[model samples]
Target: MKRQTHQLVLAILADLEVYLKTELDNVVIYDDGRGNEDVFFRITEKEHLPLVASLVKKYNGRLVTLTPNVIDDETHELVYHFDIEGLLINCTITVTDKKIPSITPILKSADWTEREMKDLFGVVPEGHPNPKRLILDESLAEGVFQEYIGLSDAMAGAATNKLWEHINEAKRKRD
Candidate 1:
């Protein structure tokens, strides 16, 4: 039943890759090895977004949601979640100059997704209409905040609070 649908999705993905000549692999399907059925896929980059979207349409799949995972001081990647009929799939794509492609063109829902990816991961989606900061404060300087401020959440919070305290103290002295 469920296994049949999962197999169908894998087949459709393989077929789509053939038609698009794109690198779409790292297909992962998880079901806890139990009664529940869950499926997922790990994509390559933005270049495959269109092909993925096309496959989704051709197979009656739906783009449910996407999230950009920024690996601070290392690598950044985007993870997309899709639901095909009754099967759920998750795909992760790393951002690279060679393969980085924009998904905004294929799905309007991807506009902000791309922007947020750029904002947090610094992966610029080539054709994003508004690739502005989605999570970061636009008023702050680029990378500087993340550099001198540090990357870890605990460290960043402490560092930021200390910096603000110093600024506030300096103002008090003047007044």
Candidate 2:
């Protein structure tokens, strides 16, 4: 049942890559082997990102979320989660370029998700209509979440407190 649907999705993706003139092997799909039926795909090429997103949408896949993580001092990884029928497909892109193009035009829901990455990781989301801060105050600083980068204790505590106060104030305003 679920396995069959998963296989169908694989076939759909393969056909899509062929139509898009992309290398199907580059879209590597693998599971964690935990018998949990969760599937993952690491889209190995940067240029094919939008094509993959388009294919997912063509298959009626919905963008669940997008997340970013500092992969290293020089790079960050952007991951996208999409749901096709009952199957989940994940696409990851490792970006060394400070500016990555926004997929909002394709995913629509990626508007804020990419903005969050931009605000927190300092990875610029080029072409983002509203390239404004999503999670941090303009005064605090970007890349505060990067644990690899050392920060002074005074700065760290101050940034944390500022963030806390901002959150509380926003909540108060909402209420």
Prediction 2 global C-alpha lDDT? 0.72
For candidate 1, the TM-score is 0.63
lDDT of 1 by residue, 23-88 (tens): 655655666554345656666545566777767666767667777655555566667776677666
How far does residue 105 in candidate 1 sit from its true spot (Å)? 1.6
Q: Model 2, 21-121: lDDT tens per residue?
A: 85555455555454234456566566677777787777877778887878787688888887777667777778887667777777787888787777777
Report each candidate's C-alpha RMSD, comma-separated, in the order given.
Answer: 6.3, 7.7
After superposition of all CA atoms, the RMSD between model 2 and the true structure is 7.7
Model 1, position 121, has a per-residue lDDT of 56
User: Estimated TM-score per prediction?
Assistant: 0.63, 0.72
Off by over 4 Å in 2: 1-3, 26-36, 148-175
Candidate 1's C-alpha runs over 4 A off are 1-4, 20-25, 32-36, 72-74, 96-99, 135-137, 142-175
TM-score of the candidate numbered 2? 0.72
